[model samples]
Target: MAVILRYVDNKSQVIERFMGVQYVIETTSSKLKESIDEFLKLHDLSYSNLRGQGYDGTSNMRALVALAKKNSDIGAFFTMTNSLVNVVGCSCKRRDALRDKQQENLMKAIENDCLETGQGLNQEISLKRAGDTRWNSHYDALISLITTFSSVVDMFDMIVEDCYNDSAELDDCFAEGNTELLICLARLSPNDSFVAFDKEKLVFLAQMYPKDFTDQDRSALQDQLDIYIHFVCSDNDFSQLRGINELAKKMVDKGLHRTFAYVYLLV
Candidate 1:
């Protein structure tokens, strides 16, 4: 389930922002819908307030799209535009079909290898156990010499191969699944619960920005972060900021605005 928050300026320009995401153990869309409704009701929000929604191009979101079509203001967009990445990571209809076919072929290959291990000429019970545990050590060597290799290869050859596969790119989007970059990120920022950036990539982006940030821009940036952290941590009405009487109270009171935000279940 996901919660989307829409930020509207005084001029009424609506910019949708991602507030939070919650992973559910349920597999079906119906069950997921029920869970989402329960979560929103707990936070005192109704479906009527949602402005825009982002989704992973899944069946659940597909159902949401159909339901949302009945509502004029709701905007739902499928987020995965890259096909290569979708092949491996997508839970969408077509991509899932390809993954299932690949799994069937892999199981066939493993079974054929196991049968060859059973018929080994030097196959003592202990030696067979050793071979069973050490399949990688002898895979190319023993499997190459085996007659079953030709059939297994032929089975794989018949399937349409995805040469320029983008699954690796899509899988890289998840920080935990990509090992090398995530490892370096963890080392660089040891205190963060999860590292979302690679140092080199971040360094390149930082270099592209202007060296000097303007005073107006800096003040706006500070208030944005300050207000965001204050709202998330305290869960109090933003109207309270205007009512505070202390140092910088006059400054804080000016830009403060009463806004409605989704109190999402954060990880």
Candidate 2:
């Protein structure tokens, strides 16, 4: 397990320091927690002081994709796309043919003014193989298909007999609650002077972690959030802030970290 510490330093800068990784023999809740506790203790820290926690478990995104694949149409679409990549990428000769065919189509399109010619425009590229671990790879593969559609179709036509092929430690409650929490988190977006900010939803999020936020903290969070939103929105320095990272940096830079401790934790 990898550990990272996010804290505000003496210079009022929000710093995310890599604490290191702890090798765990088991990934069960108790074992993982014990390992993390020991790891933090080694660095003179404890869970009591942990204001915010985030986990990048392998199952989160992969499981979501798996759930989506339960739909027959989505499942077949990805299978077909993967098969296309396998057939075209299995041989160097096939890859070269694809590049040449794509180039030929690019040239025709440019000549017909269907595509603009430029230094970087219409650069030859091969199909990308999508991986199960990262959903973005599938997105990239689909994009490549869009650019090389005609080439892929032509290649398949030439070989009508060609064969085809195919390929967060988020707990059950967290997984089931993801949709609602995600929608609430979206409301915490830093864009447009925190226009999407919702105090109730944010407090709801904080309340989910009773170990981190006590009754007093939960009550104070409401007032803190109000002040936090007002202060950030009214300030010109935060007007152009785009995301959570930028907002965090800006908060530290302006020394708001010291003033709004609870708000910064929510951030």
Candidate that scores best on TM-score: 2
Location of the lowest summed lDDT over 10 successive residues in candidate 1: 258-267
- Per-residue lDDT of 1-267 in model 1, one digit per residue for the tens? 554556787999975444444556773777667777777787788888766544444553544434434444532111221122233334454334444554564468667784333454422111001121222222232332243334334433432343324554566665443564334333222122212324343232323233543445344444444454444334333233321132133234543332211101000
Pairs clashing in candidate 1?
Answer: 84-166, 85-166
**How do the residues 1-267 of candidate 2 rate in per-residue lDDT, one tens digit apiece?**
555577999999996654555777886888878888888888788788888765546564475457447768878998899899998888898898888888888889888989877787777777987677655576778889988999999999765644322102335556779877787777768898788988889989887688988989989888888888888788899999888889889889999887988777877
Where in model 1 is the C-alpha error above 4 Å?
Answer: 7-9, 51-267
Determine the C-alpha RMSD for candidate 1 after optimal superposition of all C-alphas: 29.5
**Per-candidate alpha-carbon RMSD to the true structure:** 29.5, 30.4
Candidate 1: lDDT over CA atoms? Answer: 0.39
Alpha-carbon shift of residue 217 in model 2 (angstroms): 99
Per-candidate TM-scores read: 0.20, 0.39
